[model samples]
Target: MIETINSSKQAIALEDKYGAHNYHPLPVVLSKGEGVFLWDVEGKKYYDFLSAYSAVNQGHCHPRIKNALVEQAGTLTLTSRAFHNDVLGPFEKYITEYFGFDKVLPMNTGAEGVETAIKIARKWGYEVKGVDENKATIVVAENNFHGRTSTIISFSSDENARKNFGPYTPGFIKIPYDNIKALEEALEEENVVAFLVEPIQGEAGVYTPADDYLRKVSEVCKSKNVLFIADEIQTGIARTGSLLAVCGNCTCEGHCEKQDTYTKPDMLILGKAISGGFYPVSAVLADDHIMNVIRPGQHGSTFGGNPLGAKVAMTALEVVRDEKLALNARKLGKLFRIRMQKLVDTYKILKLVRGKGLLNAVVVNDTEKGSTAWDMCIALKDNGLLAKPTHGNIIRFAPPLVMTEEQLHECCDIIEKVVREFEK
Candidate 1:
């Protein structure tokens, strides 16, 4: 084993020497985390603003989720899909019922969950929808960030993700987000099986669509006999005000089928906080009619429904409900925006504040090539908060759902101070 490093400088040097340069992370080298706070290597404390891209929504190293993972690990870890594991059945049933879906297909990561949905949609198109063989198309939004997988990145409009990533996969049509007319036009194309989209475009700088965007799109897809697939990996599980961003204004303790406010997608893709950042867990939920298309042996993963992950996911979801994270996010998100809006009014450098729930962002008055947002983020970090710029000019600020109002207020103070003090 390698010798322990004591300083942030040592850690950074090691990463530069050994790790791939794919990511440009903030300079801080974090060593510990709790509910809404993180501690760097030198013991500098700061509020966690990003939540690991919304993966740690339930909070960092949540105790209940940790206990569940440890307990399951001590008993059984991986009994793979080759055989039935006790935890998998219960977890599947629990998740299906919890999300108001007929079935759940477990996966190990958000990208894999998205990939599974695509495969399911394609198979359903060929078998049930009677689409021509090898001619099915799935329409996606222009500025979407579904995943970095070869097929998922194929339809990306962002050159940074798509450049040199091909010979790209085909059968995907791109359309502008929040455009009902564009969605309608895309549906007109023959053999269109699904419209895969994020409820709120997280990686696209927390771009929230119109209030009724999902409902209208669902109606259009329903009329066109196409599946409405919602990629809620970052925005689901109480990260948004509701359990799912597509749930709209419904903040009920659990998903309510009676409430029409919830724009239920035909397929819901969930990940990230599904295990409360304790384990890599994700799932695709669908009704039997669409899910039944995939027979046994058609698709499976070695560690998809492992007992350890299942237990962690079950407990993680329980934490979301039991701790009332959705209600907390709704309450604090309003206050957060109000506070940020004040900064927007005072600071000419800030263009606007936009987002629903804690998944929010502020647009800097700078070109994409400029470094204003990045500089402000570094300032915020130095002043005891951690956030990062998304698409250059936009910096996303998403804290854990378990954060208290008082802690949120403190973070807002740090943000305001950073903005007011930023020169460039």
Candidate 2:
């Protein structure tokens, strides 16, 4: 066996020497993870507050998901879309029935799922809605974090993501995220294909929209003959208190369509927690009317519907429902905010806390360029809880959904102590 690297210094040196400088990560070097906790190379344990950007919502190395992955790996791994795999059809059926969609097209990552949705919407516009070729425009929100692909980044408003990344793809319209008026106005424009948005803008510091935002937007899109696409990769699979943030208080463990609270979208894009972070698995779901627009030859990925990923995704989703993670997240999330709100009221450095379910952020009352949030995160890590700052002054806190109420209280205590100490 290769010699075990026990020192954080050695691991950090290896990454710095061999890896690309794309990410500026927290100083701690993690070695193991399970449920809501992570251990560093130096054998230090810390509460996992970020949950791998919500991909580990089912928790790291969940036993059932792991068993599925291992068993499937022993049997079959990759058999591309060129050939049929035994698990693909079953997995596809399971997901459609679970989410109440007619069909699902699997991809490998969240970005690919979003790209697939875009392509389908554009094609549907031309073939079904009668929009002129190359004139189809998809509406998006400001500060959206879809992915780093050339086509996806083309419409991003972030200077860091958009700057120097041109010539960008066209046929996209940017609008204010939560502004129903702006969305309606954009829909008025000719050849509008779809309105794509995250139910809760998780990357934009857990920005929750107004209560009626999703419902109203769905109504607007339906009225205007524009497809309403929900990018629920980060907020879906029980991460946002429900199966999806778009589910809108629907507590049913089964199909979302049956529930009165559910606001059905034209296209549902999903990834991240789909495989419980066991493997890369993402999918786009829609009814036959919209999904049938894309001919087989027009779009496909080599590893899109592989058996291994399919098996993992199916088991992962079962865990979400069987464990009632949505319900758990909903309960713990409220308690987290209630506790964090007390800290916010006491401390001058914290601005406020806002989010749905386990997805939450506490904004720092400091300038964007200031180091207060980052400094606090360092302090948090030192105090045995792991969290990181986003966009300079926003610290996102999204622990795994597998955490119990008692564990949540413990994590809250750790966070409270860190904040109090930082203030002092």
Candidate 3:
């Protein structure tokens, strides 16, 4: 058997030598994780504030999801969509019912789910809306982080993601996010098939839009006959105080269509926490009319609807509902913001705080190119809490939904102590 590596320095050195230089992760080397805490290679524990970009909203290595994965692995893992597995049908049915959709097309990653939705929308535009061949356009927002795929980066405004990556894909229009007038104007263009947006722009430093933004978007898409696709991969699954960010202010535990705040999309794309970070599982949900456009063989994946992922996803979602994670996130999120707001009032280093539910970010009073936010995060890690900076000067804080109120307060104390030290 291979010898186990015990030193954090050794692990970091190994990764630096063998791995591609794509990610600049925090310096801490994690070895184990539980509900709201992580242990480093050196036996130090820290609060997990990032939650793997909201992928572990149900918590790390959750027992229910793990049990389902273990049981499914012992039976059947994958049949490659060449043959039907016993779990796929049940998973599709359960997920559709859970989200109140007519059907669900399962995939393995958030990027794959996004690609699937793009194909479906384009096809529906051609066959149903009668858009000219090769003329269909999908509108997306500026500064949005869908994924790192080539097609996704084609429409990206981030020069770092787009530099030297051309010739970029066409048939996409970029609009300023949270601007209804710009959306209305863009919808006036011919062959605009859909408007794809994140209910809350998570990667753009947890930028929550206007409260009525999604509701208005739904109305505009309906009027323009364009598909409204909400990419809730990061903001869904109770991350933003509701089952889905599109649920808006609805207080229900699950998707409730009758609620006034509910802004139903033509197509919904979900991933990340859909499997509670135990496995890679994503899905696209739509009604019969829009989804029926794609016939057999037009789209599929070898591991898309595999038995292992399906079972884990089902159990993960069940945990979210049974534990009332949405309600918990809603309650704790308010308390977190209140605590952070006090820091902003007391410290000159902080500029402001803005977010929904547990997904929050604090803007540092420094330039985007400054290292103050990075330094603060390093200090936080040293103080036994983990967080990361986004857009240079903003620090995002998103713990697991399973985090208790007492743990949240303890984490807050750590953050406060770090801020005090940094301010000095």
Choose the strongest candidate by lDDT.
3
TM-score-better candidate, 2 vs 3: 3
TM-score of 3: 0.99
For each candidate in turn, give its C-alpha RMSD to the true structure in angstroms: 0.9, 1.2, 0.8
lDDT of 2 by residue, 7-102 (tens): 988888888998998889999998899988899987899999999999999998999999999999999999788889899999999999899899
Candidates sorted on TM-score, descending: 3, 1, 2
Model 2 bad stretches (over 4 Å):
1-4
lDDT of 1 at 21: 96
**Per-residue lDDT tens digits of candidate 1, residues 26-106?**
999999999999999999999999999999999998988888888888999997788988999999999999999999999
- Comparing 1 with 3 on lDDT, the higher-scoring candidate is 3
C-alpha positional error of residue 94 in candidate 2 after TM-score superposition, expressed in Å: 0.6
TM-score, cand. 2? 0.98
Total colliding residue pairs, candidate 2: 0
Native-to-model Cα distance after best TM-score fit, residue 140 in candidate 2, in Å: 0.4
Q: Arrange candidates, best lDDT first.
A: 3, 1, 2
lDDT of 3 at 298: 98
Model 3 stretches with alpha carbons more than 4 Å out: 1-3
Instruction: Give RMSD (Å) of candidate 3 vs. truth.
Output: 0.8
Global lDDT scores for all candidate models: 0.93, 0.92, 0.95
